[model samples]
Structures are given as structure tokens and as C-alpha cells.
Target: MQFVIRKLSPNDRLSIVTFSDDAQRLCHLRSMTQASKAHLEDLVDGLGVINMTNMEAGLKTGHQILDGRHSNHKVHEHT
Candidate 1:
């Protein structure tokens, strides 16, 4: 996750969401600048153990994050 985040350009808007028993949208479409990356890295540090393995919720939240980007967005989440 850190590697992926680091690769994003400053112009890119990045969102981080984690799932366990549920899904959490830690940050949403924030500019990928150095300071913002540091802040987001700190947010990533907050992630700990999770439960239930609810992948559906994770994918749903991801789609929600990217929602207005596409007109026809149909997604599937399989456990």
C-alpha cells in the first residue's frame, strides 16, 4: 500500500480505504503531495487488525470513492 501510494503523482487524487468487519474511507481524493502523502502515511499507520473479512464492503466503499468518475459503473465484490 505504501509503495502504491508513494508512486502517485502530486496531481493525482488518492483515496485510501480499508476493510475488515466493515470498510473505512480514511482519506478521500486528497492531492498526492509530499505533505499530504506524509499525512496519509500517518493515517495508514492507524490501521490495525481487522475482522469478518468483508470484501464486499471494501469494494463498495472503493466504488463510492470513485463514483462520479464514470457514468456506467457496475462493480462486483466476491469473497
Candidate 2:
């Protein structure tokens, strides 16, 4: 995660998609900045292992998040 954060440019946008059997959603999207980067760092620090593994549900949720992002940025003209 740290590596990912480091590789992001200031113009980059990122969203965190978290999932579990009982809960799944796009945590949020933020532009990379000093504060935003710190926010990502904090999120990573607070992470905990989910004992209930549900890969299918997690993937579905992630796909939904990506779809939403794509739709939301349609004006940006995603090809």
C-alpha cells in the first residue's frame, strides 16, 4: 500500500474499496496531496485482517465501485 501511495502523482485520483461479507463499499476517493496522502497512510495504518474471507463479494463490490467512478467521471470522457 505504501508503495502504491508513493507511486501516485499529485494529479492522481484514488479510491479505497473495502469489502466483507457483511459490508462492502467504496470508502472514498481523494486527490493526491500532502493531506490526502496522509489520510491514505492513516487508513492503511488502521487496517485489520478480515477473518471472514469473501473474495467473490469483494470483487463484486470493487467492480461496482469502478463502475460508479466511471459513470461519475463520464463528463471527463473516459474511453
Candidate 3:
């Protein structure tokens, strides 16, 4: 897998929102804090594609698969 980061623009906003919402739903998260939501939006803006196989195996599991090959930009924040 490969990871690539792309700049965000107004055009991608809807896709980002949809992606974030899907992520939240997949995790069964009740609600996201404003900061968290903003962070996700920022992530989508500074979009990157991560090759999952390149990530540590421990970090790859379960819903990580659904998250696709990219780790959420806020992954480090969570850790």
C-alpha cells in the first residue's frame, strides 16, 4: 500500500463530510466533539492515502480495513 497526501479545496468538502460521517458511523461513535469534527474536515482537506500494508500490523485490524488503506489524520491525535 502507498500513502499520499493531497491538498484540500472547496470542491472536496462534500466528499470529506460523507467520508467522515461514514467513519463515525462505522465506529459506532455517538457524537464527535466540535474539535474532532474539525480535525476530520482538516484531514480530508489535507487528504492523504496510506498504504495499510506499510503501517504496523498492530495498527491494522478490524475497522481499520473499512477505513481503507489510509489512516485517519487524527490517528496520532488519538494515540
Candidate 4:
């Protein structure tokens, strides 16, 4: 499989948190607590790195940081 990396906007951050929480909840319901925590933490950390990298790149390139999903608005403007 192929993968692409990019910056994440504020909204994207929020969505990531929300999704992670939801997944954790589902995992708990399914009695997969260990997997849930590990997966969520990994996802959160990965997104944090992506966000930082993207923000830096945007600053260097003089371009707005855009969300991974919605590319219409600036990353900082999402919140």
C-alpha cells in the first residue's frame, strides 16, 4: 500500500481526538482495553508529529497549513 503524509489543521486535531476516543470506547466495549490504549496513543502521537512537521513546512513555504481531509481552510483557522 501507498501512503501520503501532510499537515493537520486544528479541526483535524479535534477530529483525531474524537475518533480516537470513540475507537477506544468501542475497544473497551469489546474487552480489548490494551489494544485500544495502544492504538489511540500511537495514533495521537503520529498525528502530533504530522501536525508539527506540516506547520513547519507551511511556515517555510509561506503557505497555509491545510487539513488532511478538508483542504479549503488554514490549519490555525480551524479552531
- Work out candidate 3's RMSD over C-alphas: 11.8
Best model per TM-score: 1
User: In terms of lDDT, which candidate is strongest?
Assistant: 1
lDDT of 1 at 79: 61
1-79, model 2: which lDDT tens digit per residue?
A: 8779878989997776554443344346678887888888788777777766566655555565666643322111111
Model 4 misplaced stretches (Cα beyond 4 Å): 1-15, 18-32, 49-79
lDDT of 1: 0.73
lDDT of 3 by residue, 1-79 (tens): 0021134333332123123212221222213444445555565566444433223332343245446544433232122
Kindly provide the TM-score of model 3 when superposed on the true structure, using C-alpha atoms: 0.26
How far residue 30's Cα lies from its native spot in candidate 3, in Å, is 9.4
TM-scores, all candidates, are: 0.76, 0.68, 0.26, 0.24
Stretches of candidate 1 off by over 4 Å are: 68-79
Clashing pairs in 3: 1-51, 3-49
Q: What's the best-to-worst order under lDDT? A: 1, 2, 3, 4
Ranking by TM-score: 1, 2, 3, 4
Instruction: Give candidate 2 regions above 4 Å deviation.
Output: 69-79
The model with the greater lDDT, 2 or 3, is 2
The TM-score, computed over Cα atoms with residue i paired to residue i, of candidate 2 is 0.68
